[model samples]
Target: MTAITQLSPRLLWQFFDTLCSIPHPSGHEAAVRQWITDWAQERGLVTIQDTIGNLIIRKAPTPGMEQRTGVILQAHMDMVPQANADVDHDFTKDPIQPYIEDGWVRARGTTLGADNGIGLAACLAVLADDKVQHGPLEVLLTVDEESGMTGAFGLAPGMLQGKILLNTDSEQDGDVYMGCAGGVDANITLPYQAESVPSDHQALRLNISGLRGGHSGININEGRASANKLLAELLNEINKLQAGIRLSEVSGGTLRNAIAREASALLTLPKSANPALAELITARQQQYQQEFNGVDDFIDLELVSADLPQRVMTSDLQQKLTQALLACPHGMMAASRDIADVVESSSNLGVINTETEHIYVQCLIRSLNDTGRDRVANATAAVFNLAGADCEFDGAYPGWQPDPQSAIMQLVLNTHKELFDLVPNVKVIHAGLECGLFKAIYPEWDMVSFGPTIQGAHSPDERVHIEAVSRFWQLLVRVLRQIPEDKAASFK
Candidate 1:
């Protein structure tokens, strides 16, 4: 039996175990979505599916709580799909084998999916609970939240009957979230022609890996290195030689929301320059290790001989692409003035791919301030434009403005104080959340976010604290019972 099956609130852990059996990675949530619907129907709960596959399971309040206001419990149904290079797990077929360790729950060589899975499972547990004294309840399980907010973006108007939204997607147990940053996706494509490699040159593949990549927006302030940027930096250093070389392929980073942990490039180098190139790569890796100091210092670089390629990028195209990537911005650009040590604006060079005719790069830009996001996006586009690449900024989402005076916020704060004997910190997150988009559809809804303690999200190191999960459940139960009678009646 899994260790989680022995945890408290047996129903919650049971549902979480069910989640582990299904592979619901971002954009491929059909199987999980159908399972959730069938499970809800089996229990006689009213289930509704939105156009984009978002599920809403409505549960009538416990008899005495009917007069209270309706509340919405929201969470994403998707998880980031990532695994160690050496792990042979297929996200579409392999189940996440999570285990207990040192009071934490982690998966073997892959993400544990605790980022939002715990939240979603909590909703299911609540529905199954006969003891929960909650009002008319709606569990909003959305899809594609890891890669984008498509489900939230397509939420139907007037579909939700609740006015108080409890977003359970937050990652900290003792802290509550009142607001979150907005984000945009930028894609740049540069056309290039490939030429046949010189007969005398040798093909070499350069790789950089072993980075501790976390959520781009959440960890952008951490001075962590980006594999994409590191690869480009190496290429730029080599470009200075002005020697004849041809790039066959260059790529790294998987998702736009994830900080790139690995990158590699296939190129043709002069047979005589292999010795110097190897030495330069070694030195560069050392410099990067020192640059990061102790954090993420396990940076690794590998240079290996490869088979000859038929085509390589033309010299002019290679030069321009290298210059553009070097000039591109990656990581935090501004700090929050209102919140100390909090990031206000940042960008992640999350993906890079070299194709037959073009090199494509993807960036996710996040900002609490819309103007700041626009400024950074414009700067990013300018860099590619000057380098003759076609760039576009799309999929923009707005930020959630904090409302400290809201009734739900006060209720949450008071509930935490009662449970923990201390006031919980209320903060705005730099990461993208679906709250802002939900507000667009239902402006009348008041929202607050909180969840169990999850660390190293969006990476294979992701884990959830076991103790925190119990506390989070207790807090949620208390919050459901304590929504003031006057406030509940006011929503109508």
Candidate 2:
């Protein structure tokens, strides 16, 4: 057992500790899936894997509760792979080193994977514990939720027999989420011509780091900076002042759903302009610090020597790309009129990458309505389109429309009041949850998302509250026991 197993609710922590030892980044969950399957089989529980790698593990109801409404506990198996710029960690093969600190579980300079991992572990704990009473239970573990939500999108009908779904992906501990924003990915491809480097040019790498890049959805309205957007703004400023600089490469961000924290660009400039470039970079760094202020206080901009490349983007292409990036829409676009202080629509300039043939730019557009989502997506594409780039949109998922009258939501509310002697906060979130897609397959299923308190999700600063996990587990167990029996006895 790891040191974290010593925490309260040891089973959940033990499972989570084991999960950290296995690499299960988005689209790379085969090892964890197999581990879960083997663990279930050893316990004699029934397990099934769907076509797209979603796992469904079933456990019979506790005695005398067999006739209750079947309930599904859902969480994703894959986690967002993020590490600090200075952390030497390979998410594909290396284990995440988790340690307890200040009453929370945090990974060392990498994402802790507790966003849904804790929920997944909670399900495992319930399955392994024979003392808890519950109705017919099924645990649905989806894959690739971070990258594209492949498992949720590809889930077919009739896979689950549950009438109520409890999503274990929400980050807030004292709240329940009934609705979430729908999303679509905007991919822009800008093909550019490469030209030989200008004579007597010096190559220098420009880096922007130490900015707090958070989950594009939950943290979109937080006024955080996107590294891709910042880098483009800096490069655009340089273009306005110095015409002698040629861009060789520019890239920032990793996943399309994460606000970029770091960005770097390689460019060649006339040797005589080196001193002027340094001065410009310093000025821009200070300007950004002042702009971000308390939100992103430690934004660092650095310029360093880089190996010279034989070719660079043509001056015209560089200018066009930088201009398009500057015009690209990011951050919160509109606020919800129905729910005060709720984000209704937003766009995140999530990622930018350079290739041999073209530069790929990805943006995630989210809104409460499909029309709004498409509007932002089209607007984002139009900016790149005007720059002579081709734009394509895909991976569209619908929003979970709010259902305040849902029985499950009421039960959760009542359960929280009984457990903590306080009413829980109920609201709709701007983040995308798989509950919306699950509705398409199981239209009659009532769904609600709740989880332990997690901070800094989708970033290296991610951490989960220790006490909240224990309380969340208690609530989950009690809710299962209190699931009203179905008069029809829906389970087969």
Root mean square deviation (Cα) for candidate 1 = 1.7
lDDT of 2 by residue, 391-450 (tens): 999999999999977888888888999999988999899999999999988999999999
Overall lDDT per candidate, in order of appearance: 0.89, 0.92
RMSD of candidates 1 onward, in order: 1.7, 2.1
Candidate of highest lDDT: 2
Runs of candidate 1 with Cα error greater than 4 angstroms are 488-492
- lDDT assessment of candidate 1: 0.89
Q: What is the lDDT, from 0 to 100, of the residue 82 in candidate 2?
A: 94
How high is the lDDT of residue 21 in model 2? 95
Model 1, 388-477: lDDT tens digits are: 899998899999988866789888888889899989988898999899999888988989999999999999999999999999999999
Query: Model 2 Cα displacement at 212 (Å)?
Result: 1.2
For candidate 1, the 10 contiguous residues with the lowest summed lDDT are 483-492
